[model samples]
Target: MPVVTTPPFTISSHETPTGLLRVSLSGEFDMSVGDALSRALVDAARRPGVTRVIVDLEHTRLIDSHAVAGLVAGYEAAAAVGRGFTVVNGGGLVQQVLDVTGLSEVLCEQP
Candidate 1:
């Protein structure tokens, strides 16, 4: 029998010419990385010249309640500074959870 391990979570950010700060997340997103996510979101939103923060969850596999709280906190932080915050590329259970929680409507980018 072999023990399996999940890869450490990662957060990457880049700024677009259009004043958007794109933050991409990868790996399981749970309580373990909630604080990091929150910090990253707030930092991204507060970056000079950034008008919006787009969270890309395309590579994020799992998201827990703590993670959801972090997202909400991030949204609030961005809003306080007159910045926009939204999420994209969430699928499967991740999307379902967001939808069920009503965050999909509030935090996701509209099609």
Candidate 2:
């Protein structure tokens, strides 16, 4: 059998307001990238003064069910810590996924 490798997706985080952390996500979000995404989200949730987290998926090209699960898990974890978690600026394919899955309401978005 030949060894297989998965492509990498980009995930970056930055502080916004006094208690807000913005996580910018892009590229394909699939099984291969799930672990990395989860780890990054967990780290961001644990940061001090981060009472809110906004996951920006505007530039994301693809997302699978596993990726949605990861986002939900991250949201739950943040809520457990009394923090807010939101998904913002998603349009086109990204928006379609959230809408069809009924996650648009569950995941907050910016106007």
Candidate 3:
């Protein structure tokens, strides 16, 4: 038998005084964590006095379509409730995907 190890996948968050939930995501933003991402966003958006969701991707190095989809889902969820959602620190491969998919400005604010 062999032990399998996965890449780092973590999510850290905080709430701002102005009704914003700021989330930081690092490691591989792939399918494995996609659902978690969506759920987290939805939870944050649905929080009392929460009018915005911001995700920081300063340490994210890899991503896939599933991740993109999750992010879009989060954005949609936020927008439906009059809440704002944006991604920042999008650099490297992550930035490329966001840009190529035409979601750079719509869903993200590059740093």
Candidate 4:
């Protein structure tokens, strides 16, 4: 018999003195955690005194359509409230997904 275990996933957040809410994602990100990601982004954007929300994907190993959808939803949520939203530090597969989907231009900083 064989057993399979999924990689660990986590989300952590902090706020800077300038009202920037930085949310960091660790491990894999996919449909399993899509709802959580959306909720976190929305909540962060709507928080009192938060002027912007940035999701850090530097440590994420994987991402799927659901994750992208969540990001879009978060962006929309932030925009609806006049708050800025963006994503940063995504690389490899995660970066490719965002680029191929044309979301990098929308959610990430241009270089």
Candidate 3 — what's its lDDT? Answer: 0.80
Task: Give the total clashing residue pairs for model 3.
Answer: 0
State each candidate's clash count. Answer: 0, 0, 0, 0
Model 2, 19-38: lDDT tens digits are: 78888887789888887777
Q: Per-candidate RMSD vs. true structure?
A: 5.9, 5.6, 5.5, 6.0
**Candidate 3, 70-107: lDDT as tens digits:** 78888888888899999899988899999999989798
For candidate 1, which ten residues in a row score worst on lDDT?
A: 1-10
Best by lDDT: 4
Residue by residue across 1-111, what tens digits does model 1's lDDT show?
A: 012234667788888889988888888889877887777777777788999999999988889998898889889988999999999999998999899999999999888
TM-score of 3: 0.87
Ranking by lDDT: 4, 1, 2, 3
Q: How far is candidate 2 from the true structure (C-alpha RMSD, Å)?
A: 5.6
Give the whole-model CA lDDT for all candidates, comma-separated.
0.85, 0.80, 0.80, 0.85
**Model 4 reaches what TM-score against the true structure?**
0.91
Query: On residues 1-111, what C-alpha lDDT tens digit does candidate 4 reach at each position?
Result: 012124577788888989998888888878888887777777787889989999999888988988898899889989999999999999999999999999999999888
Residue pairs clashing, model 3 = none
